[model samples]
Target: MTRISRILDADSYKASHFLQYPPGTEFVSSYIESRGGAFAQSLFFGLQIYLKDVLTQPITRADIDEAEEMLLAHGEPFNRAGWDHVLNAHGGHMPVRIEAVREGSVLPTGNALVQIVNTDPRVPWIVSYLETALLRAVWYPTTVATRSWHLKKIIDAAWSETSDAPQERLVFALHDFGARGASSSESASIGGLAHLVNFRGTDTLAALATARRVYHEPMAGFSIPAAEHSTITSWGREREADAYANMLRNFGGPGKVVAVVSDSYDVYRATAEIWGESLASQVRAMGGTLVVRPDSGDPRTTPVEIVGILAEKFGVRTNSKGFRVLPDCVRVIQGDGVDEDSIAAILDNLRAKGFAADNIAFGMGGALLQKLDRDTLKFAMKTNAIRVDGEWIDVFKQPIDDPGKASKKGRLALVLRDGAPRTIRAEERHEGEENLLGEVFVDGRLTRDERLEDIRRRSWR
Candidate 1:
């Protein structure tokens, strides 16, 4: 893919923004927030991904020339002189100060997550001109991370209520199967990394690569050898049992785990006869776990029934919490039609059937990555303050028809108030009140380069 000039990474109209600001507008303060929608709290993430990928590269003369040519040809007013000023005065680095809530911190909606202002007084419009790309950088992965974090809460509740499994089990309860479901490789990388903030299981290798390249983690996610439909159905229907045996033989061993998609023909018979009777002894003798995957049927109940059937053959044991669990040799993974609601319902049905949440895990795809939109969290970036003629003034929007669209006013500071995060006027901060927002990016350089391990630890905390 051709690299997009950073100057051209904005809306075409952004080229015209240099002229729209009030005369003598020397400084502009803007903020990004979740104005409240699907989730109460937003998980702040992926800003470092953006800063490292896009902003750190200083714009070149070729970039400015290319953007200027395109913008003029596209009939939008081009700020050639302003681009020249950025190139000459700032040495081609974006003259902006960006502060954000620490990556992986979870904060309530309607509060500031990130704030930006011009570091150079001459380019106040740069604050809002960069909104198109800046907000996209924060919203996508932040929303994905927030969704994954909430799923963790649901699974944690089910584990606590239904089983005595170690808390570590929650780390792999929801696996990332959203790679193919994502819109692009970059989307897969970022969205997949977001899911890894809460869990470690994933088939998205690009995510692990991203964690290493972007966040400085060696290997951030894990996946077991698993079979998909094509690999199973390729073996003739008469040879279905052979397919199950093949997975166990190749991927199974002492202390190892392998998954096999068993719904190629009939999931019921495959679970009952093929895995339970035909391959039962081999599965036990292999000294490993066989994760049976049912890819078609009611995601709410099919895996539950399969677990019951497996228990009928391999037997069951009651954990300390008095919930029944399949023998260590067998478990179920449901990958079809899964989302947060379905996962909760499935776990509820499993508990109702006396099965522990430990008996099953889930694989989420589109709903986990591609199905969400910026409005899913009602995310927005708005200018809240500006300085003109050396005097600071509050800026805001209050549309009569939509009060929810009302934006914040004045320069903001996110501080701990009553043990919770509260957004308030920066000047209202009292002595010793530490603002959670830290200067992350200063004049195109990353002030803080966070590690994935620290981010994961923060999210868990």
Candidate 2:
């Protein structure tokens, strides 16, 4: 991968922002908020990753020269004097202080998640100058984490109502299938790690390494041996049974779990006959589980029907919740056409059919990673306060056309009021109140390093 200079990782217009700010501007304070969108709350994540990956790399003279040449060629003004001042004065480290809620903290959308301000009096523009990259770094994974967290909530509700072992099964209900669908390897790694905040099952292999390297977790997620369409279909149509048997022989064992895609020829026949009859005894004797995957069908109804078919073929038992569940040896997974609505609808359909939620799990791909955008959560970073000529001034945007586009004002502090987080003026914080936003980064250094374990624990709503 080419290592583009982080200095150039901004909007072309950002190159000229240093000169646009008012003269004598000494400090600029900004905050990031979701401002209400798809969800009422969001799972805060990925800031530490950005601080460690991007901000920690000191800007070199070479980076400055490269950026200057590129920006000039692109017809944008380059702040060579500011770049040289940062390089010579502060050794190329961004002169900024960043305070954020602890990674993995779940908070309401309208509250502040991160606060940024220029530490040096000379470069107030640096606060907003970092917005383009900084906001991108925070929003993507945070939105992904929020999506995963809410999915957990949906599953948790269904499992609580219909499963005997909701707590045990909840961890593996939603598996990450977004690696190939992700825009890039880096995206797969981060988005995959975000899903791990709420679940333990994932197929995104890069997320494991990301967890180990970024959050100091040796292993953040797990996956069983699973078969895709290519591996199962390569046996030819007549030998479909051979493909299923091969998965059982190679991956199935005592107390092991193996998933096989059974929708290549006909999902109904494959589940009701091949897996339910020819290999029924083998599956029962394997002392493990066979996860039957149906890849192409109605997202809301197909899984429910397959679960009913499996229960008849393999037999069913009524759990303590009074919901029918398949034998431990056989289950179903729906990997296609899955999203928040489809997942909930499927669970609702399963409950309506008297099947336990544990009869099936979900494998979410593009919808989990690539389909969302910054506006999914309505995330935005706006300057809330600035210091001019050593006097503090509150700043905000109030558009008459869209009141929802309004931004917060004044230096802010996120504090707990009656056990709930409230964004309030920093000066209005009462004595003895603890601000949730702690200084996480300062002068190009990470002040607080968060671990994945703690982050996952904090994410549990």
Candidate 3:
């Protein structure tokens, strides 16, 4: 694959957007928030991606001209002097800096994930002007992380309600099947790692590359050997049993787990007749686990029904919750219709039908990575405080038309009080340096590089 060089990356209006910022504004402190939408806004993600993709990445004079031309074409005001400043900088590096809570740390409802400021006094507009780009950068990862965190809570609750070994199986509960479904390779890399923050299973291969290139990790996530419909059905309908046998023969054995999509034609027939009856003895003797995946039918009930059938054919043991579970040799993974709402419904029905949550896992595609937006979590970046003249003035926006649009006031710091995250005015909360936000990127340098393992630990907790 050929890598494109000197890509023009800023939003078309980004230059003009900063024009309204007050002149002589020596300091600008803004924040990124989730606005308590759909979830508690646990994960603060994507800063690492932002630093690599935007700040540290080189910009050339030609790239700046391309952006200037784009602004010209769109009939929006463009700041020529600003673009010239960037072009003349060493390697055309971005002049602003980013400070924020460590990526992957969880915060409260209105906690700030990021704070921006201009490192050079002459370029005060640098930070405020980049709001469009910064907001766009963080929202996707934060939304993806938030949704995955909620799903993790659901999975954890289900396991706690059913499994005796909740922690042992928690990380393997949900796998990322969202790579091809993502909007772009960049989205796949960001959102896939966001999902991996909560769970260890994934089919998003580029996420591993993101972790390696951006986060500097040996390996961030891994996946099991799995088969899609094409891999299974290519054996021919008459040779369906051969396909099943070949899966077990190749990927299954002692101490291994492999997933096979079993809903190519008749999911029920495949599970009951072919997998349960025909391959039951072989599966038992294989010394590994066969994860049967059902890709069609109503996702809410099909998993429960499949678990029931598997329990009947493969034998069952009652869990501590008194729900029946198939032998450890056989399990089911549902990879279709797996968003938060549908997933909750499926688990509720599964538990009601006397199947332990451990009997089934999940793999989510488009919904997990691509089907969300800024409003999905009500994300926004607002200028909270700015310095005008020699005095610092607190700033905010309170729209009478929509009171819900009111933003936070004053410069902010995320600190720990009584062992819990508390958002306090940076002026008043000048105690110990327990502020959760850290300076991750300064000017053109990467300051606080984080390992993906550390990020996963912070996010999971």
Candidate 4:
């Protein structure tokens, strides 16, 4: 029922080991005995709790035991000894001061929205390894969330059509095809789901599941009937059509099927002949609707003609309810090569021909995620200031004139004012500071235990 269920089940967790180390790990024992080792242990425990909640899967005792076993198993004599020495140097818990922007806030590039520092002067280097992965995990999600927010703004503006329909207008679904080979698979999943918080149009099911598990977004987009089956079957109908039918039957028809790709064979012909009649009838008869997709073809002519056919030959009627009904009536969705400019052009032509804005939906993929210029959504991380001596130091970029790359050194605080989130450098924070990163874990216990759905909802808001 939940999205996380699609990717990982209880059985999978049961079979997997949490940590892997070498056997006869006197190293672990020795390390655990040391002060630095204790701090590392605390950090590790804290990390596990955060990750467990983030992952939304049970972190069992068996899983932890398995992880220890694996770590010991993989530890060489030297590694074990080294690990023990490293642990002993920092036996007590090291205070970690973390300041981060609220999860949903928009952040600019080259900004230190999050600053993690070891509060204990003795074990500064202890938490270094954790930083890379931790930052890596958080960065992509934030970027995706920001991008999705902008995208929602654009969609809202584009679909500013006057209608006397129901309160609900367009529910967006994002499909992250760029995940196939572009970004890290996990990053793609997280990013796609982040987008769903603001823009509900995403087809990254795995990410959706992750999002649902960590952030409760109930509905997600799927391209099984549109792209998946055909891509798997080499354009053959046996598997493709069967898969489509199965999905329709299982998911309960076209209302569930957001956009169906009929362009695999012939764009117009498929709309009129291939899936045009049967699919439309099946959806309509089931009290559902399908969005006919044109994945390839002249965007200008194909969509307009398809809409015309659906409105004219198919006897589709735009009733007061804003529902277009025809024996072959289905919303037209353009996927491949669709951009803002192209979408604007398509919408203009459709309007000129008396087509209702709600008569079509857009399944955006590569254009929104990958095709945009690299600099369109600028994102980066920079160290604002580092404490060298006892006194807090103010650090700034050498070339202060180039404000874009400048960094405000020291501890930083972020605040939302008048609807916009702003960052105040530590030196500039004359007022009280509001720390963004709270104590997620303390002494190997979860201090903040939130449902994944709750986090998702929060992220969206």
For model 4, the stretches where C-alpha displacement exceeds 4 angstroms are: 1-86, 89-95, 107-112, 126-131, 162-169, 176-184, 200-202, 216-259, 273-286, 316-329, 339-341, 366-376, 400-402, 417-419, 427-461
lDDT per residue, candidate 1, 1-461, as tens digits? 68899888998888888899889999999999999999999899999989998998899999988987888899999888887899999899999999999998999999999999999998888888899999999999999999999999999999998888789878999999999999999899999999999999999888898899889999898999999989998998999999889999999999899999999889999999989999999998999999999999999889999999999999999988889988888999998999888999999999998999989999999899899999999999999999999999999999999999999999999999889999999999999999888999999899999999999999878
Pairs of residues at least 3 apart in sequence or in different chains that clash in candidate 3 = none
Q: Residue 345 of candidate 1: its Cα lDDT?
A: 94
TM-score of each: 0.99, 0.99, 0.93, 0.65
Question: For candidate 4, lDDT tens digit of each residue in 112-162?
Answer: 454555544533332332343444445445444555555444455435552
Clashes of 3: 0
Comparison by lDDT, 1 against 4, better one: 1
Better of 1 and 3 by TM-score: 1
Runs with alpha carbons beyond 4 Å of true place in candidate 3: 1-8, 17-19, 87-91
Query: What C-alpha lDDT values do all the predictions have?
Result: 0.93, 0.93, 0.82, 0.47
Deviation in Å, model 1, residue 425 alpha carbon: 0.4
lDDT of 2 by residue, 1-461 (tens): 89888778888888888888788899999999998999999999998888998898889999999999999999999988988899999999999999999999999889999999999998888888899989999999999999999999999999989998748668899999999999999999999999999999999999999899889999899999999889988999999999999999999989999999999889999999999999999999999999999999898999899998898899999999899989999989998999999999999999998998988999999999899999999999999999999899999999999999899999999999988899999999999999898999999899999999999888884
Comparing 2 and 3 on TM-score, the stronger one: 2
Worst 10 residues of 4 by lDDT: 26-35
**Residues 1-461 of candidate 3: C-alpha lDDT, one tens digit per residue:** 34332323455555566577778777777888877777765688877887876678767777767766766788887777766776676457767667788888888777777888776665676676667667888899888988898899998998889877659578889999999999888889889988877888888988888878888776777788989889888998999999999999999899899888999999999999999899989999999999999998999888888888888899989877798888889999999999988889988998888787888899999999998888887888888888888688989999999876788888788888888888778876865657777788876788998887788878876
